[model samples]
Target: MRDIIEIKRIGGNDVFTIGKIDIEIYKCVAEDIVTDEVIITDERIQHIKSRHPDDYEKYCKYMSEIVKNPEYIIEANKPRTALLLKSFEDEGIPFKTILRLVTSSDNITYKNSIITFMKINDKEWNRLIKNKKILYKSE
Candidate 1:
């Protein structure tokens, strides 16, 4: 018996069809490896735009704010803390969380609009956490 087959190629991959049976075959063979990746399409974009316009606008506004304030890209120091506080204020994230991440020692001081504190290196910070000198704020 001879069977008719329909083959379709989509997203740089080949799909084979024999009657109702569909199979995906690749040239390269590997064991226990993931091959297929999901691709987002224009239809999905239009659907999201139509359904969640407010969310899309909020994301754009947040990105714009970040672009406007380039100093937020710095490390976890006083200046960075101030920028993060501003970001938290805009995003409704708690200020205490931001403070906890930047505060290394109990010698944190505020002067005018800036906060100053001892900056701990990553190694020391890891050691402190390991010794339980300072509890991790995240639990």
Candidate 2:
């Protein structure tokens, strides 16, 4: 079996494939807010605080910067995206086909993460879905 792995976003809709798995991408959009000292209320921040309290302050500070200005995150995520694309190319998979399918789909509002789904050809699908009986005889 051949599998394709990569991430893509079309019309703000995010999609990705990993091996034979397919999924939809959902991004957590940070809301712009104003406060006296910038509260780090994101779940990620809390989680980091619990596990890495030593770095929690710095992590929260960084998260605040990301929330206040998202361009940094966008730039940071680009290189990771590029590496993922390279991985797919190395795997001999057609990443463009998946993007085309998502673009042609009716869904939008997904972005910035990788979701993967198993997409089998019609012949394979039929073979898998068809009812069959295995006969075994022991002598």
Candidate 3:
């Protein structure tokens, strides 16, 4: 059986509620080179579920793998954001995980949190590789 990464949730007062969704922080271990701990929030998951249910259903299971060992890490157009991408097979289609570095209310500490995941077409994949600065690429 393939190993599944452990994700822990922080609840109660630590949770943040926005709109109809209650957001909780989930912490998980990512591969080295990226930060050791990766955070994901419920709000982001809901955003994906509401906007791209098909992609969410298909790629949600691979969240850990994508974040832990992306084949390509590219700089996102938005500041403090990164695009982590990996393909499951030889096909050009790939799953992308968007990670954002959020500043805590204190304004000093920052945490890396996943914002969303989606499957991108080959053309878009090629464009990303061609236009963005690749931060890392696994051999």
Best by TM-score: 3
Top candidate on lDDT is 3
The residue-by-residue lDDT of candidate 3 on 68-92, one tens digit each, is 6678878777765668778888544
lDDT of 2 by residue, 1-139 (tens): 1122344554464333322212211022122211112121233334544654544442222322222222111111222121011112233321101111122122443222221112224454334324322111112
- 19-103: candidate 1 lDDT, tens digit per residue: 2100121111112222222122234334445754643333423322222232222233332232221123454422111111112
Cand. 2 TM to true fold: 0.20
TM-score winner between 2 and 3, please give it.
3
Q: After superposing candidate 3 on the true structure, give the runs of residues whose Cα lies further than 4 Å from its correct spot.
A: 1-35, 90-93, 102-111
78 Cα displacement, candidate 2 (Å) = 17
- In model 1, the runs with Cα more than 4 Å from the true position are 1-39, 60-90, 93-139
Candidate 2, which segments miss by more than 4 Å at Cα?
1-45, 72-139
Winner on TM-score between 1 and 2 is: 2
* Order of candidate numbers by TM-score, starting with the best: 3, 2, 1
lDDT of each: 0.26, 0.24, 0.60
